[model samples]
Target: MNQTSAARPLVSFDGVSKHYGSVVAVHTMNLEIYEGEFLALMGPSGCGKTTSLRMLAGLEEPSEGEIRLDGQRINEISSIERDTPMVWQSLALFPFLSVQKNVEFGLKMRAIAVEERRQRARKWLERMEILELAERDISQLSGGQRQRVALARSLVTEPRILLLDEPLTALDANLVVRMQGVLARLQKELGITFVYVTHSQSEAFAMSDRVVIMSQGRIEQIGSPKAIYRSPASRFVADFVGANNILSGSITETGEDLKISTAVGEFHCEKNSDRDFNTGDTLDLVISADLVQISMEGPEVQNSLRCRFISEEFVGSIVTIFAELEDGSDFKVQARQRDLANMALEEGAAFFASWNAADAHLIGGNGA
Candidate 1:
């Protein structure tokens, strides 16, 4: 657990479920949201990430269990009084209103004085670095400018927590990166909790202090970006995270270094003390693509497989080589583009892919 998990949670969903008729949107979820931490709920569409965010925002009421805010039961509380403001994907800016007016809309609803609302709006606009655009009409501003307006509007009341549901989806690729930095810096500076929902893996892993992976209305895994990427807790997590090769195998021996027999060949991995494995137990091992090395000759590694080159994908300086293992299972190796060029690997060429036994992580077992 990190420092955030050690502290008392600012918001919590205890055995929470949201259902409509016979269909379940969220099912029996227990999660804690720490104060001043950026927590991202990520998954595929219809995975209930948005619904979870809505429940926290008081936009949707849970059919079962409780939603709490600052140790107070808030399931029955109204959205306006919850102190949880939401920034929508559409930005939802008023086209008829100027930039400053759009930001002051939230304050005005709270019955704050007109002068005070104007001052607060101006202050936030300056903080967002859009003070010069305060007087411009909403239609005259760019997408990024309007996003700032939406953020200022949601934050004008100075709420304790902010809810964002794919607020950066409308921006272009470059703008999304810029806004990620903006949001990360703003959350750190304000020291307030941010519960963000998105389907993009890059967006979630790039900015979140911790990530919640949900599938079919159930929580799959919750951990820091590095933890989820390097050591997935389950096969579902390993597959959903991508760039990982999960090999099905059965334990042939058990000790400090367990030997597992798979279709490709025999492999060994350091035993996880948390799990107990007996001989003949079925399990899965996760190997990150970046950890696998490809060589023209078999390397001196604990785990090595002869694979046939299938194809390669290039993303700037990084390259991903796809190959088929002896068992016909797909494997991948990620390395520098220049380094791979030296090998001059060709389609259908045979090569050895190897990795240290310590790099393999185990999942699934009788005591997993």
Candidate 2:
């Protein structure tokens, strides 16, 4: 919350890499995790997210590079000795143990006095809103309740860093939403560093201060969710972070702003980052389907293009219209039903799709 104090990262991954014989689980990872920040590592399966977390937890050693915590190197630190606690997906609570006992398991292992451990466990259980179930058996608790108990168990020790590995995957959708809020509030209240791993974009965007999008054992991009979504650094990130219609195009002009010529038309794009582009350069443009608007009649808009409606998909509040350009290239546009009703569109109908120049992002290479 306080940017001044949070300027310095609490954990730094300096050119870290981990290899398993012929396989590279993590390839030259370099990252800075700020203190009290909730950072999420997101990617598809086998993208080194779990491997990276394992290396941080000292469960696996990096074949190359170093890991630092609070300015001290922690690559050699053992899992139990490090000033961090991990919450596994399984909850890992003993089936026969009461909620209170399960929550205090770590403290007891550390040789804390029984009374002190109970006091701490009770405090955390109450904080997690599970005090009433302190004596309930783990098997009797619901998925959400078990998750809270596991969190209380981890937080009871008051670790400076918390590592969560898809801790909400087992919960239902409604409960997952509820837990996302809980985790967000907990991070703000505790002011502790949290490194979370998940494959869910909604979860990462909803709860993280910054998101690290990983792909094939490497980081694709690292930034706030908005930046990552709006201005992805690479094609992989652009496609992964959200719904995008990736188009192949060439740069017809380059200067103060970029002008790309695609199958549909030549369009101008906002210049935010220093991306190299020149006339006749090939590039990719990622435009979100939701950002485009469709109308039966063409609007006098700069980026508007005429297309034929191929199909329509009704999804809750918005309808996704699939359309094809004169060149036979297809893209999707999402509009509310009321907006579509205004157009009175039909299948195989002619329509114009348009978006702001600023809404399109240039990726991959200079559009030629």
In order of appearance, the predictions have TM-scores of 0.97, 0.94
TM-score of 1: 0.97
For model 1, what is the alpha-carbon lDDT of residue 22? Answer: 94
Candidate 1 wrongly placed segments (more than 4 Å):
1-6
Candidate 1 lDDT, 1-368, residue by residue in tens:
22543588889899999998999999999999888889999989999999999999889999999998989999999887887999999988889999999999988888999999999999999999999999999999999998898999999999889999999999999999999999998998898989999999899998899999998899999999999988898888898896999899999998778999999999998885566779999999889999988899887777898989999999999999999988788998998898888796899999998888889989987756
lDDT for each residue of candidate 2 in 1-368, tens digit (9 for 90 to 100): 44475388788999999999999999999998988889999999999998999889889989999999989998888988885788898878889899999998999989999999999999999999999999999989999999999999989989888999999999999999999999999999999989999999999999999999999999999999999988888888877877777788888888777888888788888765665667888888888888997777789887888888888899788888888888888888888878777675677889888888888877877431
In model 2, the worst 10-residue window by lDDT is 1-10
lDDT score at residue 23, model 1, on the 0-100 scale: 91
Candidate 2: residue 169 Cα off by (Å) = 0.9
Candidate 1 global lDDT: 0.91
